[model samples]
Target: MTSTGMTGTDTTSTGTTGEPGDRTGAHTDTDVAVVGAGPTGLLLAGDLASAGLRVTLVERRPHATGNLTRAFGVHARTLELLDARGLADELVGTGTTLTRLRLFSSLVLDLSRLRSRFPYLLVTPQYEVERLLERRARAAGVEFRRGTALRALRQDAEGVTAELAPPGDGGAVTRLRARYLVGADGVRSTVRDQLGLPFPGRSVVRSLVLADVRLADPPEDVLAANGTGDAFAFVAPFGDGWYRVMGWDRRHQVPDDVPADLDEIRGIARRALGSDFGMRDARWISRFHSDERQVPAYRVGRVLLAGDAAHVHSPAGGQGMNTGLQDAANLSWKLAAVLRGDTDDPQALLDSYHAERHPVGTAVVRGSGTIIRLAMARTPLRRAARTAVARLVTTVRPVSAAVTGMLSGIAVSYPAGRGAHRLAGRRVPDLLLAEGRLYELLRAGSFVLVAPRDTHPAAPEIAAAPGGVVRAVWANPSRRGALLVRPDGYIAWARG
Candidate 1:
């Protein structure tokens, strides 16, 4: 099969299909069928195919039209996930890292103080991430069907059958069968609609303008953001020659279909940010509205939803894409295990996807909503309160840590099982191993068992507890006994 790269390159796609004993009478064309070739689906499909499962990714958009600049900031935890897949360093080189995030005119958050290898948010276009993930997915043999629209979907006890509309008008429809299907489509998700799921939320802000332009005179700060009583503006570098500028004007609240002239954007930016920095020569511009919406359930029987398909929020914290990427990381391994028959109770394992991620999605929606609301505070008292809160978050140590931890995604953790170790379900920091680092050990895309160095000689056997778990030893040989790190770099289980 032919696979088209995001850079408009051509490649071949081939993958091995898994045949579980449970599929007695039902035969699937692929192990997993993924809709939407965005970052979430690409990562999930790549991980599945790397685990020796056949994955077919269907995308409604054409390959050549992949340049989307909606999301620009990649948070630290997302960089760590890419590190596990050996793509973080390369991605980092492609963009600028902003250690200081300026909000409102005076308040600043120091991202460099975050406790992680990637201490700053990387400013790059969303396509850069898609480019890397698409390469990996194609190299891992994930079949890609571009310009194919999902028409209908049905799931039986055995598998999911997806009816797809091929490229071009009035073309013949095709059907693909798979044991599981994932909808990583986007905020306007067809799969979610097909599942009859209601996206419950309200539009927080409207008449928001976005543009990528060549700034004749750039701002001194890597990132500049501020919100006046009547307008708000945010500016950041794309690392290329162009920069991303977004703003909103309360006085000019027009419909989204109205054309956003460069002059209007510059006027709003100058009013909110003090200066437009000679913004000119726009390459792309659009007016949009942001809504805080999420699906009630991420998983429904054999079909699951991810990324924007599962949740969407105001782009206040720059967590939209990062949250989706993490969602894929959290769900991909469990799906692979169930499809491969590594787990006995597949339903429980699949159900955990919704159980663990729904709360996080809720938190993201609320947190981002809070930020955007504060930024758009119009009343004098509310603006004062916003300033006070910002000051507390920047000055108070505990408050700063909490806010930064949640925003940077380093402090996010899932619920541990009953009587489990304290570290269980928490993200594991990259520790120095005898040979390399924790993330390096995860490049194989499987569970990793890390034992203290110089432990009992049977440590390797303990690591090989069942399935395909990789073994590693701590470089310093601490008092900690053993830690089973999930493929996504969370503590599955730990014994001290």
Candidate 2:
């Protein structure tokens, strides 16, 4: 996996199997080229490769680790997706679980009320998640072209072609062609730029400080956040010996790149929190502003965008990575189906990704924006009113559950048509039948038909469906009714 051997120079070799990433047949390889190796890209690549599609994940960086991430919360719906892939247990084992989220002094989001297998939110940094997903992608035989940047992207009705830059200067460029190209690249995406898509939004907040330091005493809560009228602060642990602290001061409206020292950050934390909790050992420190931005379209012919390339907003509920992960899950199956010609109508299958995900991405941006704006209340009266309304909403059981559901993504559903069945578009719960949990059945990477015991061999005709379309598995007839569950755990077309 050297740059010279890969995209740097026109050198190719053929290898048998279980190799890191080998060049075969010399010319540009792969059915699909993924522009980024983030969560969305890795998940989509893993699913695509596992489905026997040639996937090449192109990342600008040589290695996946070392980047400090602000993402620490994995919601219930995301946990269910991970469970389907058999990766949830490992993440759950390594992370801390918190039943509630506190955005302000008098406001708390109760997550335990959410009706799901994983009611509590898992608090672990994004690096842990990336590590696991990268492992899964590699095991799926997805080729990784690291230390190479996508310099240009162009596409036609047939396929996409990309020009890539080498790791160092004065190096020769390489050209790769694929049937489809995905821009999972970050905010400043070259793929998006080449396609001339407008990222329409403005910066929400600025001069926010981030520090992962060792605290003399960590808070008792798994996660904590508080906002005074003038400042805001939040803290979450890495489950190791370090803590991630984020805060911003409204009084100091300075440039984002202005160098921030520990003393200034600690003072802001002290204003937000009663004490800094002996904040010391400033291991990592940086500053960034939250923005609310989304592209007008997710798909343009053979090119599609996902993750931060598609949308971005404030990290109020830690929904950025989770939304991107779910987006990957939603788009992967559809893309694989179309690429493999598994579906009857490939265009419809491809269009459904945008129809379903664009609205969801829009909702996330709005929700996250609301949270950040409410937290940034400039007046004491407004802050008090926001706190009161939030607390009151949590006091009511149903409202609290709905709030948690929104934040956790458990309440996400698509349009199932005007005369659709009651269960259509609803998320199928992970039922525990006599054999095993329902998500265990989805581990094979396909849709499934769960029916009563009498229907054990009912779907024999569909059991060996091409591209793992659908299979029938019997559940407890008395408790759970027959249903058709989509690969992402949503009830596509079901009957009670």
Candidate 3:
């Protein structure tokens, strides 16, 4: 039976609510439907809905929890992106500022070298970031459907058809049809599975122990690290005297079999931080080995993957969340353009997302792998060598800046194709505008081109692109200018 109901309830065979009727007959229609309400999905949904697109976000989980501490730091670039969306100040206010990231081994490297308004990392739990994003998404009029799972997806000439099931009962199936679908699901994404995408990568021989615990005596320092030998430990202070501790298991020689017990945690802390440390209550604990992997492509037909679904790498550099957020920002603008009939070449623009992001992901995987190996080298010779290199780099100002740039994600640049200027593929540094700050100006919407230098003769033509906003100003000379900044805060084009 062909039913034209908007309530998401339609009868099918077997008397189930959402069961597909005949493969040919079932399809629900909307502008965009996003699978998973994680940070990426929520942020994308919010951006799309805020831009006046109809969006529906589905999550498999029945309720949100505060237990997991999956990701801990939001880098400077991420803060700038959120600030562009008017979200950074609120989030930064809640999380503690990581003034310095000190690397300790045979030698020490202080990360205060990176210059930014947000010079240090912001330490906030993954759940808290998600909570804030979810609130913002709701405020932006995103339709959030909790306790829903996407069972199957099929795309055709017009749009995509997704079969969704309610959580526990598995009672009814709803057919949601959308012009496009995004899979913001995590590493083990069902959408990826359905699309038959290849997630190729390698897993390191060693794994690390990660836990969020209430220490009897938390470290006074914002972050402490001991990386002298095969055994290494890093402790960072979260709010409320709780600490997130990560360390290598010296005795076991691997991350597997590391118990989630307080006793084991205390023992690790004793080795990494000194014997006097006391660990009282364990909040959450897990074992994770580094995996460097990326999907060969970001899109298959109308379904697209973002966040962990597209790339999963070592947590050593804290790039996971920041990368995911940027992915959403990049995709959101393109998706909005296509939905609004402003772009004729949707696939070309869609391909640009992967083209721009894949290389960045590759670099992150390689850089983070190097850092992890250096931190976990067992042999005395290799450890000594790693220590010497770290110390040398720290002493050199340019080298330190480079390392800080890598960690802060400010150094990433995307391709601007042929005939693009030097600023192509670079992040536009926050600049001073005649009216206000550059970041403040971007808070309104996506795609801002700043003509700070007044050098580009084509500034008028470039700014006049359909559906784009360009701001022209005189060069400060103290700062960089004439940048094509994406909604995600990365420089798409720049001038020397």
Q: Assess the local accuracy of residue 115 in candidate 2 as a C-alpha lDDT between 0 and 100.
A: 78
Q: Judged by TM-score relative to the true structure, which candidate is superior, 2 or 3?
A: 2
Which 10-residue window in model 3 sums to the lowest lDDT?
1-10
Clashes of each: 0, 0, 9
Best by TM-score: 1
- List TM-score per model, in order: 0.93, 0.90, 0.87
Model 2 lDDT on a 0 to 1 scale: 0.78
What local lDDT does model 1 show for residue 396?
91
lDDT of every predicted structure (CA atoms): 0.83, 0.78, 0.72
Q: Which candidate order results from sorting by TM-score in descending order?
A: 1, 2, 3
lDDT top scorer: 1
Off by over 4 Å in 3: 1-28, 104-109, 167-169, 205-207, 228-230, 253-259, 452-466, 470-472, 475-481, 493-496
Cα distance off (Å), candidate 1, residue 32 = 0.6
